[model samples]
Target chain A: MSEAARKGMKPKKNRAGLWGIYLALALIYIWAFSGMNLPEIKPTAGQITKSIFNGMFHPDWDYVSDPGGEDLLHGLLDTLAIAALGTFISAVLCVPFAFWAAANMSKGKAASGTGKFVLSFIRTFPELVMAIMFIKAVGPGSFAGVLALGLHSIGMLGKLFSEEVENMDLGPTEALMATGANRFQILWFAVIPQVITGFLSYTLYRFEINVRSAAVLGVIGAGGIGTPLIFALTSRDWNRVGIILLGIIVMVTVIDLISGYLRRKIV
Target chain B: MMNQPIKTSIPKPPSKIKNYVTLLLVLFLLWGSSIQTDSSLAELVAGFPNMMDLLNQMVPPNWGYFDNITDAMLETIRMAVIGTTFGAILAIPIALFSASNLIQNIWVFYPIRFILNLIRTVPDLLLASIFVAIFGLGSLPGILALMVFSIGLIAKLTYESIEAIDPGPLEAMEAVGANKIQLIVFGVIPQVAAHFISYVLYTFEINVRAAAVLGLVGAGGIGLFYNKTLGFLEYDKTSSIIIYTLVAVLAIDYISTKLREKLL
Candidate 1:
């Protein structure tokens, strides 16, 4: 509309518009920060910081090697076990459901929709919530954590597996069908071979995530490092908390390395 | 004469032995882990009745509890919004520094990556617990925890995307004598902006779900009510909270997914 615009002259940078956005964002930050009621930094804040640093450097050696009940090592093992078992169980159990959920594989639209809906429902609850519910059912322990992780993983694994199934090369299946193979025969010879690698990759990936989840499940008494973590924090035992945190970091790192290596090798 | 007897050596399908051994090893590990964790079919079967009872109790959720939880739910969303926005803001620098393509010096990117990995290993629950200790109880601790969590996530995702970006603009910018900051601003940001926003929204979706449970450790959110209701064995009330959280999470997920689809 302007002669300069019509002549293709450069327009001014919308400085006002840019500033308005910045101001709005700043206001939002202020509102949110105010809602938090952040505690004023007291002199004790310095002491707390110092203690945290000290604890980080000097973790409780006794607790780290303690062979007694529910020590860091035992907690680490339990967490690993939960993650491993949960991933395995979910990978095994998701196969049927995945087939049911895959539109190309399922009997009809209704079956696929129902399968997907069930999975969505399963996935709705956070792992912690599921852990709590499982704790209520099975009593708080690593077993409950495993159950929680497994049940929650089914939703994810099923979805991933179904996608794999849906996108699979139809060549093999069509070939087998043309040879008058039965449904189960075709599935065994065609579907499983194509999706096995993807299924394993997804399961391994899920295991890595589950390890992290299992580490924190104990906060809800579902059982893991999280219980000791909360205990130490509550009672102000920063040294033990430091050790637990360290163990978790090491465990996660090692698991990630191994899983990453395996995934690369397989996939 | 008949074609010289075709000597076809079928390459023996590479070692079924190896495959069998790997399968066995995996199975063994699974069995051992199942025993160690005390997770077995029998236990699950035994717990079926209790699970049924819990589900039975959860039906007919206490609708009245919705009024009480509205504020907490809003606080949770606000916490996620603030946490994710702050995290995304902070992540830009870290992601820039950590990206191997952006920072040619291995030393610079390596240490940044180590820090990112270390940060990511700490679960949000653990972060909240530590923050709650320092901040005293409230949504402040939850916000801080989510912020740290988001930083690790967004940075990791963003740096990976940054590494995969087209190098043409970056090289062109450099050839034009653009400074490091200028190159990033004009070249890098334009290329990665969509991906970065998508990562931020994805992280926000996770944060919303995570925020709902931060209250378990006194970090503040609907999880406080979750703890309270469950402590009182008020399954009906707990069910309502779960329902509300489900709705919020699903809505956020849907919107974020749509936004991401548009972006990419």
Candidate 2:
């Protein structure tokens, strides 16, 4: 029992090691916050209460029914269109690229690495940055926004697809290959069926994201509801800001719920 | 099994209902999208000249601007490192609570999950913009945004890993009458720490890319230079920024990928 007691309760000989880790983590945080000029965020209880109430009740619904509100609605519609198109485009492009990028399928280091690099290069640039670049090239408009969203979405979706492929059950793929099916046939019969659900799930998820991205494309003149939203904010039109926020929240929440349902069904 | 399949009826061509339905949907999607987007082949074709013009301007990147981008690039990487470190630290408690294995209570887990889900739905750009608006513009907002973004990402990843962890150690800890804190420290943390580190590094890589673009909204870092170059229509400078950012991202990615490979 004395030997067992000692065995159950190991002596803590290196408490300093744990403490050193904590100290290092602390130093990192302090260093990170070193140049942070944290402003006094004094949103008085009263201001918060007002904002909540204003957001809830005074949503400026009248603007939605106004003639000018038509413009906002159009912008919203445009954002949705862009996001949908972007997701669709990415779905079309990414599925094959993802397969090629998957290590299992390519079996060639060059193909997978090249595919991965292409995808990472796409992911490295935010949509806004992409839009700015494309806008400079193509001139400003929804076209630029669509292209940016599509390209970036390709990068993201391709990467996710590759990960899914990498993690997929190898048994089915091997079985298909053993049947002497060609690459395309094997992929179609084996790989695609297995990963289609995941593909759809990721695509829907990206659609949810593209909705938000499309909204902000306006900030960079990519042409969406964000243009007006930014304009409203700049003009200090809290009433309009309130409307935009409400609209955005509703759009986002609805999309989220739908996408969540779709994702659950797919997964 | 053979007898059951022998009774199969002759298969027809694609079901008219399904085929037509799909065809109609495709047509509708194309028509609706084209009209809604005001997109046309004519527009795409017309835009080529301008694209070429822009590309021509972008070529032969301004070698002189390379030096300025170095500092900006360094700042961006630093912002990502700081943000990711802070976020990774803060994620631990939230991830713990959200994990099904640790917190058997649905009440605590669900609420935290809902919050994380909501936070994740808010894209990094939107978060940065909101923070910039609230805090005024600079790297501070960028860093804060990255922190929040990293937290959302890492916590979600960690909890998923937590849910999938081996339960034997957890039961063993419980059998030993260890308290919740001790059980987690010894049982849960050991199993998940590597994965947690992997996620943090993954988030750091994302944050670097994210931070590079944060400056577009005046949140700070290389994105400011991006905005300026593009604003002045200095495509060469813009190209230089793009190239530099690409190199930095590629380097970070290569290192992180190598490290992550070893980690797991």
Candidate 3:
């Protein structure tokens, strides 16, 4: 500053680091893109676009409101039910596990580590894989979907809940302990209250995600809209596919708005 | 003193009735939905036997199947890498445009955010299936789907972080009469680069997991094997695939999480 200001000259920017990063990123991009084995874009692009657009504009309304058959409405309801039940079951099951996983609550590194490992193991399996396994167990229906979503949600919700517990104000907990309250009583009166709102917020967020997942779980015969969606696509029933996609979009949007509002109100 | 205290005006604590009402409503909804979905403890109990049977069948995994699936697993990782890289590239401009603190114009940020939200609403599976239809069954479609998904996620996360960054440097750049591009390059980029890299890595982690299943929709990946083994009732091979995928995912997650910890 002293030298440059006195000379009335602007200092050069030190851009070597930035340039290096850009160079590395460029190399990575080239390597990765080349490895993808991308197929050549077919000349049928225009036809596919036109067909998709046409179907979108003319979604089968009968399928939209059909009450007597496996229509968009029925599929939407099933997806909603799956997400709700899954979120509820997981949210409930997460409590005890979250308590065990929270470093503060467990009060031992070994116990908390074991709990974290269990959660990580559970989380490693994608909901789709879990759904496939549960389909084998419960035999291809909404039950399998619910169980799969519920179990997967436990991994996510439990981790989040334990983090919340770990970060909570310990003053109240200590005060309760000082008052000669037992561990369970302190947990109920002190710990649970502080984290309940955060727990609810996470559950709602997971529910939103589960709704989207439930839509796709049906592809593997785990029940919900995915079954109809995959079937329509496979059979080249563009009109039906359009309706299903539209239903999914609308349902997801509505859930997003509601959950977003609730999260803001709570968190 | 007691009489004076009795006359003191203390505002009552807000009633917890609202909380209880919401809780009850949520509980009722869960109950009704459980009934509607035909999910119950009884059914779960009955399914336990089947679950055990499946688990028993999977205990001795077909380790020989590892050779067959190795290339597919590599393809899955490659797809994630390429897709995440492409998405990170696309996300830069979108995040810049959508960041309220950077863009300032409501119209610009709002429209971009709407588009991002709409993209995010489509689940990765649906996106993969759609791309498969458009591009035919291959890793190309899977790559495209992951790219789009990563774009939505990365842009959203990056833009939010961009908005939260300190405004002091940006203001200083403006005071120095720096041009718009110069201001951003010298100010915003430096601040957000670390966060952007962290977000990119996180997206890669998610994409790896997502890509593993993209094959289910014929978009190409390890999911193809999942479908094959499950269709053939070869739980042993399925278990092996699961184990391999789990190891890969866990390794990536650990590395990325550690990197993110350092960045933050």
Best by DockQ: 1
Candidate 2 lDDT over B58-107, as tens digits, reads: 89999999988887787788789888988999999999999988899999
What is each predicted model's overall lDDT from 0 to 1? 0.90, 0.81, 0.90
* TM-score preference between candidates 1 and 2, better one: 1
lDDT score, candidate 2, position A239: 67
Q: What's the lDDT for residue A183 in model 1?
A: 88
Model 2 Cα lDDT, one tens digit per residue, A1-267: 699898879876578977996897688667656655554554553464365346546766767755754565777788888888878888888877897888977869999999888888887766677788667656777777877888889998999999999988878778878888797887778777888888888988999989988987888888777787777655655667677766776787789898899699768
How big a share of the true inter-chain contacts is recovered in candidate 3?
0.62
The Cα RMSD of model 3 versus the native structure comes to: 3.7
Give the distance in Å from residue A8's predicted Cα in candidate 1 to where it truly belongs. 3.4
**Can you give the lDDT of residue B87 in candidate 2?**
92
Error of 2 at A190 (Å): 8.1
* Candidate 3 C-alpha lDDT tens digits along A158-226: 999999999999999899999999988997999888998999899999999999999999988888999
Off by over 4 Å in 2: A1-58, A64-73, A94-115, A159-202, A263-267, B1-16
Q: For model 1, what is the alpha-carbon lDDT of residue A158?
A: 94
Model 1 DockQ class: medium
Show where candidate 1 strays beyond 4 Å: A1-43, B1-11
Report the lDDT tens digits of candidate 1 across residue range B1-264: 777977688767676999899989988988888887887788788998999999999999999999999989989988999889889999999999999988899999999999999999999988998888887788878888999999999999999999999999889889989999898999999899999999998999999999999998998889999889999999999999999999999998998899799889
In candidate 1, the residue pairs with backbone N, CA or C atoms under 3 Å apart (3 or more residues apart, or in different chains) clash, namely none
